[model samples]
Target: MYKYNNFYKKNFIFKIIENDIRNKKYNIICTRFPPEPNGYLHIGHIKSICLNFSIAKFYKGIFFLRIDDTNPSTENIKYIKSIKKDLIWLGFKWDKNIKYSSNYFDLIYKYAIELIKKNLAYVDELNIKDIKNYRGTLLIPGKNSPYRNRSIEENLELFKKMRLGRFPEGKVSLRAKIDMQSKVIVMRDPVLYRIKFQEHHQTGKKWCIYPTYDFSHCIADAIEGITHSLCTLEFQDNRILYDWILNNISIKHHPKQYEFSKLKIEYGITSKRNINILIKNKIVSGWDDPRLLTISGLRRKGYTASSLKDFCYRIGITKQNNIIEISSLESCIRLELNKIAPRAMAVLRPLKIIIDNFPSNKKIKLLIPNHPNNKNMGYKNIYFTKEIYIDILDFSEIEKKNYKRLILGGKVRLRYSFIIKAKKIIKNKNGNITCIHCIYYKDTLGIKIDKKKRIIKGIIHWISCSYSKPALFYLYNNLFIKKNINNIDNILSFLNKKSLLIYNGFIEKNLLQLNNNNQHFQFEREGYFFFDKKYSNKNKIIFNRIISLKKKNN
Candidate 1:
């Protein structure tokens, strides 16, 4: 229960709440996590999700999941579906059906017209290329558009024509009339609506004119009665435009925007632009590739829903931008799986063990406990035989004074099995040792009964080599090899080449019960692992290592 001190609890939630209340803070402040549904969610999004949702829960206010799917050209229904799946996987859910920027399109258009009536916005006839040029340098104010002085009726008529598809694409755009000399580029007459003749995934061709994310976001918050519009720090520059829109329309309840440092995760790229490039270039398998940091990929790679939520809470909230070491995620998962997952034996690089004393046809069965720390989950049985397998790395053909593994005349302990001493070695013409022959010590079963029995320093896991089951084991880790992605010129250079090293491995028999929907387990002396969404079927079992064996006594 000590974990409750650092974990989510009602006491801690309101404890922070009372402090904010006693400080004359805004009352009943709601928060919203507005994700643009253009790609699968990532670990970076998890940070924002936790911050916004936890604050809402902590304050006893409603939290909203609003999809900012205004840009239909780059957005899709597929992305929205993925976002909803990822969110539910993370264990956070909105109370009602989710809100969408496209859902409030008509309201946003009317509000834009309100701004037009007030002469705070106008239709710009400049080309996108020419508009950037006319915006001038940062040091100088942008020159006013030749069409800036158009009458409100003329601008509204043109806008109506734009809505009715009377204008060609790139002919004109509805832009805010804010001063062009403002330090933030967003304040320099930002575009509100564009003439995209493409069909929208949601509205299906009902409307041709679409509002930009910048123009639709803040107003959507107000419409949903969201008190705090929590978002990333990059949007800080756009806050002025958000406020300008609110003031122009005089919304009864203007939402306040708060910016926190965006998560710049090490070992991964969170930028949609970069992810899109990866997809375009065919450098990855897909958005759901196990190497990817996207939620789809993580789920495919065998990460559990609770592990992700626990990871977010462990990182907590901070105002400053920091590249989290990424090992923090590894730690959280290892801790989680170790507690819930069953214990199974697997040998990735098998070194054949031939028991000399036991008959070749003899077998042994182990009733091993599933989870050692937890009791309700009882035991499992693994069939063992004379011909068993241990990791090759756990042995040496040449005798080692310090090594207690299967060296000539040395004793070693098989994990929860028996004690054995090496007697001979079997090799092939290629000068490779294929099998190591050892004698089982009947006097010393798992632990030595006699104090004088040679103390074995080497302990290892072994599966019946004669009754081996073919399984694909995946070794997964951070995708990026470098710490600072910005420091590297090409993202491919940072790609961890060793991210996934797949190999054939042996598994205990009961493992059949542990291969669905990310059933997790820790292989003795190997690492924590789980079943990947891919490569998992009743006929074939595939697992990906969630983390290397914990770095404690091991």
Candidate 2:
């Protein structure tokens, strides 16, 4: 497991890229992140990003960003562009020489020709359905195709015609001539190339025939001179096919594939298939919706690149399948933010509290540290006044034991300001309490008993109504209501009804003067939040709670 300490971050990074001037230990360790351009990258993809790029960085070699856009029907140029952007955003820079699976079509076709020449592969005219029947099933031996016995010359001519678009899609396929009952089913004459008439985004109409990933990936790695082809565990079985393809064709470099377990975060689905289903059904707002697990989604939700890297590092890597608690990830972000995020004051679901004894328009600014324990972040002032807005949940009309907040004639600290005691309850015509009017005891009561004396049972945050700014607060909880967001239960039904709540809230005046470029802040006694980068400004800012403070690792 890669440790979370700076040392581990440094070593795991370097291990992938060890320098050797003597050339005795190892050669330039070239690695590639070959993502199929069908969907956006998710948290799981980040683990791959870290492993591949960090290895390249560690070995002083190259990390190539190769778009494995072989499937023309589903792959898109938009996804390719977005994946490149995602890598850059994740703080990874690939080697200058970029590659795409489509770029090697010429070489792949040449290799297919070589396979045909060696009598190691042949063109099979069997339609996919009949081919599957001939390929047999789990407990039976497959029968050889009728076209399997075609003369090498006839097969070559037809293969060239297949490349020249003489055949319809799937009417003919180029398959490897491996064992029919080798036990390992994939080795049983697997299809290496298929014909797709669809316009490929890249290498458009150059050839109708394209090599499958199993065939193309190994050849590409060898062509690029990759040393260690690290991939997820799902490819372990595919290693046989990859080896067969590479071994049959002599290449400059023979890369070894090593598989590790994929990352899984519970309460989140990282599957592009599932994401596509959700999107097609209009279940999510968009790819960048904060509720999603896509890179853009996480970024939109205010996840910092460094924090995400730390989370990936903390989770470690192994070959065993794991369904990590989403809370573990949240913990990493919170731990990092706690060390760097600035502190502020915000009250959501504001309950108006008017101190009648104090001057109606008075504003007293109290010095508050930007980071409670770190003065180097500097200090800002929070205004306290006669009229203030506290959280509605922080107060109860009827008191319970240890319910330290506002109630009938109860007293509590006003956080950095004079303590006030409720003197009267103001109500509406329907007997619902409209507001609670109180009197500030500036001398003998509150968080500060005097200039030197203090009484603090529970400190609650409030924003001055007289001087503070009103912000639109978006409070978000876990998107799913299910206990296991990964497996079981209907995720669609578990989608929290109250995931995103819009409220007109109050913030300290200093928040109004806040620099919009910085998206991080912790509202004292409230939660962690960031001013929305896309929709916040000085006059009226929109703040989104990244996560609340009540959330702790259990």
lDDT (tens digit, per residue) of candidate 2 on 246-271:
88886667887878888887677887
Task: Give candidate 1 regions above 4 Å deviation.
Answer: 1-28, 399-404, 449-457, 486-489, 514-518, 552-554
For candidate 1, write residues 210-264 as lDDT tens digits. Answer: 9988899889999988876777788888888888888889688887776767777
- Clash pairs (backbone) in predicted model 2: 16-59, 17-58, 17-59, 18-59, 419-446, 449-453, 481-494
List lDDT for all candidates, in order: 0.79, 0.79
**What is the alpha-carbon lDDT for the whole of candidate 2?**
0.79
**How close to the true structure is residue 86 of candidate 2, measured as C-alpha lDDT?**
85
Most accurate candidate by TM-score: 1
